[model samples]
Target: MFNCNWGFMTGFGPGGGMGGFGFLFNLFIFGLLIFLAYKLIQRLSRPDGTRDREDSLEILKRKYANGEITTEEFSRMREILRS
Candidate 1:
């Protein structure tokens, strides 16, 4: 049996902090990629707000037709459009 004495450790490791720094750098790059993906999806989902607004109106109309909104409620909401 051999006794090994490569004792305690910090996250940054013995006299060299680069491993921890590299971990953080990779994490940052990963987060940036995720953010860019989200933005790309958002951009692809709705290239223009006007079309999105029209789609929302169609959904609202469907909801109204399905009696999700009562006549009075629909009338009141007609004065205020949502985006």
Candidate 2:
């Protein structure tokens, strides 16, 4: 005689015998994934200089050293950045 698995098929199904805990667990996992993605997007959207810790003063120095700006312009820009 073949018997039907009503206990595992009818109300609860095969997602473990726990009543509604399986659904709750899946929901928790989905929420955690969303939270992680939001955090990742926020981090990626930020400017690279903030992450690299490059300051405006350092950039001005590099520009002056590269001869991209005159000495007077470099000093003025450096003063502006320091303020």
Candidate 3:
């Protein structure tokens, strides 16, 4: 004789509750997916070495503005960067 009870199938059987662990597991997976997507987007937004070159130029400008480099040195580096 087959038992007709289906409570276990619905997590309603004796000692069947997951005690909220299932919700936590799903939340963790969702957060991991979101983090991975953000990282992928950030990585794809930069094209080739342009971003690095621009960043270097910006740093160079900052150094010149802060008086960390002489006019001749700044002009020399600026010319080097343009090439």
RMSD of each: 11.5, 10.2, 7.0
* Greater-TM-score candidate between 2 and 3: 3
Best TM-score among the predictions, by candidate number: 3
TM-score of 3: 0.57
Candidate 2, residues 1-83, lDDT tens digits: the string is: 99676433333456555658755766677799999999999999997666343477778789999999999998888776655
C-alpha lDDT values of all predictions: 0.69, 0.73, 0.78
Candidate 3, pairs of clashing residues: none
The residue-by-residue lDDT of candidate 1 on 1-83, one tens digit each, is 98554322222345544577755765677799999999999889965676867777787788899999998877666656662
In model 1, state the lDDT of residue 2: 83
Stretches off by above 4 angstroms in model 3 are 1-17
Estimate the TM-score for candidate 1.
Answer: 0.39
Q: Model 2, residue 81: displacement in angstroms?
A: 8.1
Q: 30 in model 3: Cα distance from truth in Å?
A: 1.8
Ranked by TM-score, the better of candidates 1 and 2 is 2
lDDT by residue (tens digit), candidate 3, 1-83:
99675533434334546635645655677799999999999999977788888889999999999999999999999898877
- Model 2 C-alpha lDDT versus the unseen true structure: 0.73
